[model samples]
Target chain A: MQLARKLAAKLVTGLVMIWVVATATFFLVLEMPGNPALAQEAADMQHGMSPAQAASATAVMFGFVPKQPLPDQYRHYLWQLLHFNLGVSIAEEGVPVSHIVASAAPWTVILASFGIIFSFLIGVTLGILTAIRRTTRLADGLTLLGAFINGVPVFVIAIMLVFVFATILAIFPQGGTVSVLETPGWNAGYLGSLVVHAVLPVACYTLAGLGAWQLTSKSSVITVLGDDFILAAELRGLRPLTLARYVARNAMLPLFTILAISFGLMFSGAVFIEEVFNYPGLGELLIASITTKDFPVLDGAFLLIIVAVILANILADLAYPLIDPRIRRS
Target chain B: MTRLARQPGPDPAGSAAAVEAAPDSVLAPDRGALGDGDAAVRVRDLTVSFPTADGPLPAVAGVSLDLARSHITGLVGESGSGKSTLALTLLNAVPPPGHVDGGSVTIEGVGDVLALHGADLRKMRGAEIGYVFQASQNSLNPLKPVGKQLLDLGRSHGERDQRVLLRRARALFDEMGMDAARVLASYQHELSGGMRQRVGIAFALLLNAHVVILDEPTTALDMLTQALVLEIIRKVHATRHLTTLVISHDVGVIGDLADRMAVMYAGRIVEEGPTVQVLAGPRHPYTRGLLTAMPRIAGDVSEARPLPGRPPDLASIPRQGCVFRPRCPLATRACAEAEPPVTVTGEHRFACFVAAQEVS
Candidate 1:
């Protein structure tokens, strides 16, 4: 009963958060200086159209806001949001904002999820190893490596990877998610090309995030190692593997919260990473809509990001009790 | 794991009988008269040292003693007096930076413990010698249920029948007066302080180790709980026919629970005797001072004389002469020249130059 209540509370908070973001985005998008309709009209006139024709074209193309009062527009936007309907994109005339987001969301989610999972796994494993062998030269070397990779910007790493692996060596594809030669089906060739294209962007994501996980997990494991329970376990004559399990399990508790937050933040990083690789993820869509002043699509994408983050946090809260028994009682 | 308890522990008949009797009759007065060959564990000139910036300084200086078979020996000392280190040496698990540099700990059935390493060392720890750590209330895996941790212990030691191991653990929990099913299913935080301490004992004895060490078993407990824990330790020790070592700073605790008492000053054992005899007539100045300092209900409150000078840390301990001479009211020029030699009188032994001369 309590679990259901907690989940209900979290969901309500999530809805409120979405409403706040939607309201803020509506006002903020409209408040931007220089009208998009006037800009579109000027561009249309430059194409040798008459002033009347340019105005008509601009009215038809840039229909981001309808002719209505501010309060009515907000009410209409809220009503549309309630029905999960983000109106048509202004830039990509006649394309629904939902349809555009639906196509792009998967790419970003897949890239970031794989990157986060791989980085978290590798980092935590190495962290446990280094913590146990902290005084050794190899551990010290790994610490240095983690710090170095973490210090470099994700884009810089992405650019360097491109230069070295794609440009200089010609070992991998330079850009795009898949080759045009391959059909988008359940064939091996298509899937292989997809993986090949995701390699550099994912590598950038993993390398950029790996260091923080490694260092945090290392310190966490070290602290757990000093705990009296560890000594007690040792006294109980637990095998080396069993001892490592105890240390790793306890150390990973605090890192779970960090992992969830990292999952949410990965999209923010996707903006740069997806651009560098030219992968058509939400980040790419966001950039394209922003450049063209597609306010509807932009607002929809922002709302999607906010919802994704809220869902991740909610999942973490629900999963915490399962991992830590101490939380179950309280 | 249960097979460990089946091994003959000193005198089976006497120990079995002691189990059924009251706590007071658990330790027969004349058991201290037992010969050295009858000892369950013997430590000879044990010196544990820690490396300092200057050099390796001895934390537990050449201390020799014996734990009589199926006897509860109490080691009393102030903080940093090396009592805990001495107990740890029996398991050959002195914390790193400090190690057993000299002496040997020999259990009757097993060979020298200090020489054992890796698998041999590990097997000796829980299988042969059980250790209840100081503040054992907190010495549990916070993430795991008590039962899961018990299973982990069983798996580690290659116990073929998990059912048997668990049965023995539940039996121990029952004996310790806990709701076995609920406690086994619960985490450390779920149990109260007394319950956790009892669980600590259950874990120690779960493997049926014959040689058990309880380091400050009642340190963090309330007065009533401390009494209860002490009673539990006494009952458990008697029933198991175990050779036990209890280390505490409280003289009252030692006087109440110990069959044999050894007083440690700094890193060395300054006095050793049967509990009754030692409490009656303490030969060492430090032991007498410690007894005097203890507050009592029956005695005049002002008569309780606090021992002068604070206890010394590893670096602050004097290198020459007797370790206790600086704080001794009867210190002489002769006490400053060299370390005191052990003077034996019947079952009691003390290291004091002035006391030895006075006895003569």
Candidate 2:
């Protein structure tokens, strides 16, 4: 019953978000600021326009289209959103917003997916390690470095990595998802190149992420340390490795909850991070669409990212019960 | 776990000679007339301290007690009385920031428990001295089922196979009058608090340690469960001849299970005696006060009198003085300058400048 209520609430929240985005798209594109048609018209002028067509274009650019009311236009836009009809790009003529986004979504997903997953994995692992070896010199040093690295912004890390690897040391490409000469494909060769390009960004971001991720396990460690079972386990006098593993396993319960949140945050957070590395991810495409007033394309990317994050959070909530039995009974 | 209680403890040579000459060692009331029978644990002048901004403050101050074979000794004190600190000291689990300033915990065969470091101490802790903590629920792992956890416990001690440990775990469950398979398969959360306590008991006892520090084991258990657990402990103590230290604030609990009891206040043992004797006629003013303080449904109304004033703060206790002097009503000028020497009887012992007057 609680799950049903939670899902129903999420559905309502998602629809409310869609409505707001659609309304914002309508006002900002049609009512406010610069003309969407102006960019199209400028391109059209170079190609040559008939007098009637030019006048019609100029009037539309300055809001002459009263044929379709604002509500009707909003409805049309919402419908287009539902049907995956992200309209043409204003920056590049004859280019559809959906098509540009579609071509670039995978790159972003790949970069962000790898980056987030890798960051979470590495971060959670280090956190657990540091938490377990809490008193050791190694753990102390790891905690110190993780805090320092994570304290710095992602862009700073990205730029620094770029300077060291791409500029001064030229070990990897300066920016971009794949090499300029390379054609992106599903094959291993292309995927391998993409990964190679992704390594520094993943490492750079994951380092910052590790501070929070691993710190999660610290609580788990403390919890495990307090567990009477450990004392009992100690009484049973097991090997050092077994005792450590027992502590780690019990501690892993809460870390799972932290992992879910880290996954969501890192994925969405990769947007700016993607642009910084010049990776052709959805974030970069969304920026391009926004600059040219391509509302449909921009809205699609915005809505998708928002929905992705919310869904991830929801999934995390739903999954917590399965991982820790104590939650389900509650 | 080495069997400290394997051989029956004999009388001292003088007592043995007297018994041989008079045929009364078997009926002798003075167990102390006998020599020490390889004290299962000998904690000598133990002082455990925790660091603060000012300095390291002693939590357990010069607590010297012997836990002998086939005996149940109860450590009785209210919270912050340093009973738990003393217990932790015996286990050698005083974490970082806490230091054992001066003490030696000598367990038979295991040697100095406080001195033993790394793997040596770890080995002794589980195999030799089994421990039961207060919170039974959180004491066991939640995710892992009871059986697997038990199996792993055994596996840690070189019993690696699931089948072998599974059999042992089932045997233990059956022995505890619980369903072997159900308890084995059930997770920690699935069981009730009492059931978890039972599992805890099985875990501690199955390993067969001579000394088990049950730090308020039944504190969180229900009344019926407490009775059942106490009964089980008595049964185990009798059958295994285990040396048990049951720490509790409930004097009734100590009276019920302990052969001898030690009363702690401000990290010092104010009184120690046979449970029945202490309850019936306490020698220390604090002990008498504790007895009088216990709420009664059937006792004479005039006899009930609660002990006034709280226990002293061990952190800033006077360097040369009785720890209980601040609260001890009968304390004289002599109590302020030095701790009174322990007064001894056949088996009972009391530490108070006014012990002479508190007793008959």
Which regions of candidate 2 fall more than 4 Å away from where they truly are?
A1-32, A38-67, A129-144, A182-196, A226-232, A265-267, B1-34, B300-303, B357-360
lDDT of 2 by residue, A1-330 (tens): 988997899778867876786677557656546666655556556679864576567444432332356787677667776776765555565466667767887776666666667766787678777876787999989888878877888788888888999899898877776766666778787878877898877766666576776666666687788776776666567677877877877777777766666555543566666778877777777667667766556666666666666677778878877867676766
The Cα local distance difference test for each model comes to: 0.84, 0.72
Q: B-chain TM-score, every candidate? A: 0.90, 0.87
Model 2 Cα shift for residue A17 (angstroms): 6.2
What stretches of model 1 exceed 4 Å from their correct place?
A: A41-63, A66-69, B1-34, B135-137
**Cα error of candidate 1 at position A264, Å:** 2.9
Candidate 1 residue A253 C-alpha distance from true site, Å:
1.0
Kindly list the per-residue Cα lDDT of model 2 for residues B1-360, writing each as its tens digit. Answer: 246244433323323434544322222222222235535677767888888777888888777676756789899988888998888888898755788998677666676677688777776776778888775546676777777777767766665677877776677667667888898878888888778877877777655667788889788888998998898888878877788999999998999999888898778776777777778768788888888888786887777787888765656566677777777788899889887766655557677767754543
Work out the TM-score per prediction.
Answer: 0.91, 0.85
Q: Candidate 2, B292: how far from true, in Å? A: 1.6
Tens digit of lDDT per residue, candidate 1, span A228-326?
999888888988899988988899899999998788766655888899999999999989988887788888999888887898899999999999988
Q: By summed lDDT, which 10 consecutive residues of candidate 2 chain B come out lowest?
A: B25-34
**Best-fitting candidate, measured by TM-score?**
1
Instruction: Give one digit per residue, the lDDT tens place, for model 1 in B1-360.
Output: 343444433443234334553222212222223364557887777899999986999989888787888889999999999998898888898998798888777776666788889998887778888889765446888999999899988888888687998899889988888899999998999887788889888988887788899989888889888988998999999998888989999999999999999999889998898999899999999999999998888989999999999999888888999888889999999888898877767778788988887777
